[model samples]
Target chain A: MAGSDCLAANDWICGEYVRSRSQELTDATLQHLWITGASVAIGLLLAFPLALVARRWRPAAGPVLGFTTVLYTVPSLAMYSLLLPVFGVSAAVVVTGLVLYSLTILVRNILAGLEAVPEDAREAARGMGYGPLRLLFGVELPLALPAVMAGLRIATVSAVSLTTVGAIVGYGGLGNLIYEGMNSLFKAQVLTASAICVVLAIAADLLLLGVQRLLTPWTRGRTNARAARRIRIRARKAAV
Target chain B: MGAVSGAWTWLATGAHWAGGDGVWHRLGEHLYLTVVCLAISCAIALPLGLLLGHLGRGGALAINISNAGRAVPTFAVLVLLVLSPLGRYGQWPTIIALVLFAIPPLLTNAYVGMREVDRDVVESARGMGMTGGQLLARVELPLAFPLIMTGVRTAAVQVVATATLAALPGGGGLGRLITAGFNRYDTAQVVAGALLVAVLALLVEGAFVALSRLTDPLRHRRRARRQSVNSRGLPKRWVTE
Candidate 1:
């Protein structure tokens, strides 16, 4: 039955398909990458300080996180449409909405990472006459790198998918290919575009994983036990 | 300012509330799509995740599948299927796309939830002469309930938000409102549609929170009661409030 439709529909998946669509593919891929990158970058920039504030004032955590939750809960297409009156069909609208989407995860991860830093480490730093600022930058943030990287990986991958939804507004990366292909019933176009998007997402995730491994040498096999111990400590602290 | 008021007025008008294409009808379609997609995805992901987590194998595979799935945008999947033979039928393409979208969070969260249950607790349960099924039922599930619920909430919220895409294939939903507004060049109607979706998402979130509270057999964990016992008599009862 499926074959009946693709066959009768006059949509061919062939060599010429790849040749003719090269430029469109390249442009779409770039747009997708750029849009996804910008969302993650902006989300991280905003989430860092916001997370720190929530970390400092326990009371503000609920309201601040609640606001991000509301923002995130807005449907993707609706979020795009919600901003239509402001930015029209521009990439800014998608990026802005996605940044808001990314915040909930980013802020939560940043908060978790900061909290993961052992209290004893902080106390020891303080005992060594380190100021709050010094302790944060030199001690806590370094130890928190693995968790932060995990957040980055998640945000980037989700951004890739979210950017595709922006196609309804005419800026969705390879989404344009699928949209155009479906309209014309072009099987090759749809298949190729989906494959590429999948590749891009996996590549990005693996790249981030490598980066995480590189940055957090302590997370490697030798120092892995130390990391586990620190995690246990953080868990115990959370329980109390 | 103008857009907000215009949208409010547009929503207030009675014409938008009646007929097959009315807001109420579209809302039914939207809810139907969300619930169906969520139910199917959960059915597929929950058991597999729980089983793998219980056995402590295949976690990396499930997680990687979810992570890789992030790249296969639901829109692309929907349109591709819709263009193909499988899409020739009723709402299968739309349903399939939505199912794929819902799977990652549900699978990942459920898997992680199972794995994250305390090892010591499991050992203690085993030491107490409990069988695997008993340990899983009495100890593992209760401990994993919150995370599993969190995953369900994530999938449900996502399904609710993304169901707007079903309008593209002329399937049906609040998405019809959004696309129809765009086609008619009515920004106010578009704003109204988006607002309704946002409100709906929030409502779904609230419903899930309430659902979890009601069904969490392991927890009646206090939102209000934090008892601080003293060495002295009666523990000097006082509310954190």
Candidate 2:
């Protein structure tokens, strides 16, 4: 119960640990963020082309989707281990695994988004003399923003969670702290590190949500109109 | 390739598959943990999802809570639980963490599936004087079966993957093989352990897919419709996380 003895007592929530190890915590958190960001970015890059290929060739869609789904089914530990031989004991192992795991969600969403573009919209773009590349970039992708962003958010959060598994290779960021803390039974370090991971995931999700809202103004407009119509209908019923 | 061959040799060793710390024992532990955690998650999540979904209320709250739950890493939860008083209770900490990890997909998918049941169908069933229970069991549940099964598949696979973490905390599972391998710097052992976990996860996923297809109440009708629609290739929505 001594104020300064929280560390000695191995309390679950010791401020002393955080105060003393602020630099270590910060470094871990930054690494976590960096890994999550890099993986999601690379996933998007790879998924975009694959999604495009799947969209362009009906015959290829089944295999592309099937392969990614299979990749996703591999356990994270196994994923890293499988890549370990190639990437060795480095951050690349974690990043490669995460990128592979992310493909299932990213590719599905991207393809879904592209497919959802109203046929008439594409027709109009075509009529306007837009080339295939121009049509995809100018009209189809913009319309597909919401679904793509949704995928990004999910993939980002998943990456954050999966990144901790990278701790097995000493590249798990905060996961390393949690792993070490758990092994030594260091209550404060485990709790604090875990809490930070939860926070990072939530913050990343919120940031992506904000980005989605900003990028897809038309989606917001449609929702607003739907809400306004509901309100108006309720008011008419009240009068009756 | 050498590493893979090494792993293959490790797996092929008859000695490694016997005794206390052998592959069979670890696999049993892994399956036990996966099954127990999944059963607990389904029991807790499915009924709540069904009730809320049937009422057409509070589903958003349930789904949001589960979604938020997804943000918390399973490893962190496992470590924290094991470090707490629950640690003294043996596998309780691991079970608790895994059950928590498995619930979100089950809950969300169930709720969404039930809610997605056609409103007109529900109204028609109500008009036919089917009681609430009858309607839920006969109509709504059948319609929602695929989504619910999808959730189960998702949760099952996730639980299998995560149960590996239990071995890190001195609990029992195939994860122990990986952690032990790491300690000894035996790359082949780690690879072998990883291969086992991956195979188990894939097998669980495949089992659920087969089970869902076989047991689907509307399988005949669905197959007929699918055949007619086969010219268009797979549906865009076929892939889900």
Candidate 3:
């Protein structure tokens, strides 16, 4: 069986698996970046404006959000199928689906962040002679940045994972490597693809975490201090 | 399968399915595949999660393991597993891969839910002459139920969506229609598949939302006004009501 063979053939790449396809890996990574990068950019562009409009008019928020949630549930493969006739099996369909998938998280979070702006802050802003646009840009947006960032983080991770599925439609990505590896029973290739994916996922997660901490300075310090205080209190109680 | 057959029959001769035979047959298989995979996943994950949660040891490691599980692509895993002596393909490999896919969310939520309950509540229960078992059964379990339900809802939607991959390996389902639509460049069949999946997701989400309300009495009163209006065919009034 290939499972046992994969384990026994410690020198997997050296044996029949010595397929020097490094170019394929590089091409796949580039395709993945473009696909994900474009999707997130498009999602943010649409979601931010809609989120702003929805916040100013409370009635619009719920329906817009509900529509996006349904869009989120629409499967990637199905989305491709739906778009195939008009767009054909190109990168356009893949990116469009990814963008649609990003909306639910981005919109929901943006709305949540805006709403979380304490009413008193807005009142204070108005008292200070700030206009609606200025109040949102200066006060509400900054306060909501953490939540918005959190949503973006979730969207980014989701996009990365979903991009793998896009490879099935002849769009090259790390997933193509995995698919090829599996088909040929090439352990090294499969492992290589999976490792790159894991590293990418972790690197993205840690990068987002760092960005979140940096942007939400007050939140980071307070949370870390609170955690430290809890640990200290528990340690003292245990010692007593 | 029903969707595919409908698309196929429509392609052959744009005709209505007679006696609903094709629809029921296709729906039955799709539902069967979904149910079996979910059941298998729950069987493995539920108790494992509960045990790990109650112990509160290895929390980070368990979560990280599940996170890695989440990171692995389900379809890729299927392809890999299928290549082995598990050389068997189709629904079985799909089921196995989906089960693995579902475990992380289920375990993570279950663990976090029970672990994050108010320590003071546990202490109070203990002081009131309750054993750990009693405390868990009456307090911890009830409190964690909502969070666990969220995980279940997430897993259910994910399973239904991913189970379509079974069609890739020769098993039949609505995904077959979608995949076939892609291969043959048939737009309507693809639309049919996408629409069905979207509808299925909404229905499941609605069902779970109702179930969550029924299980939690506190939410019942707050959600009742909305549910009653919905049942009365007045979705417009439901949110405001």
lDDT of 3 by residue, A79-161 (tens): 66655555666888788888889999999999999889999999999999999889988999889999998888778777777
- Which ten-residue region of model 3 chain B has the weakest summed lDDT? B14-23
A1-240: candidate 1 lDDT, tens digit per residue:
554454455555555566666898899999989998999999999999999999999999999999998887888888999998899779998999899989988998888999999999999999999999999999999888888988888888878877887877888888877777767777887888888887888899899999988887867875778888999999999999
After superposition on all CA atoms, what RMSD does each candidate show versus the true structure? Answer: 6.2, 4.4, 6.9
Docking verdict class for candidate 1: medium
Model 2 over residues A1-240: C-alpha lDDT tens digits? 364599998898898899989999999999999999999999999999999989889999999999999889998888888788787899999999999988899999999999999999999999999999999999999999999998998899889988988999999999999988988999999989988998898999999999988888888889999999999999999999
i-RMS for every candidate (Å) is 1.4, 0.9, 3.0
Local distance difference test scores for all models = 0.84, 0.89, 0.72
What ranges in model 3 sit over 4 Å off? A1-19, A118-130, A179-191, A235-240, B1-26, B61-70, B89-91, B116-118, B217-241
**Cα distance off (Å), candidate 2, residue B44:** 1.4
Pairs of colliding residues, candidate 3? B1-B173
lDDT of 1: 0.84
Candidate that would win on TM-score: 2
Q: On DockQ, who's better, 1 or 2?
A: 2
lDDT of 2: 0.89
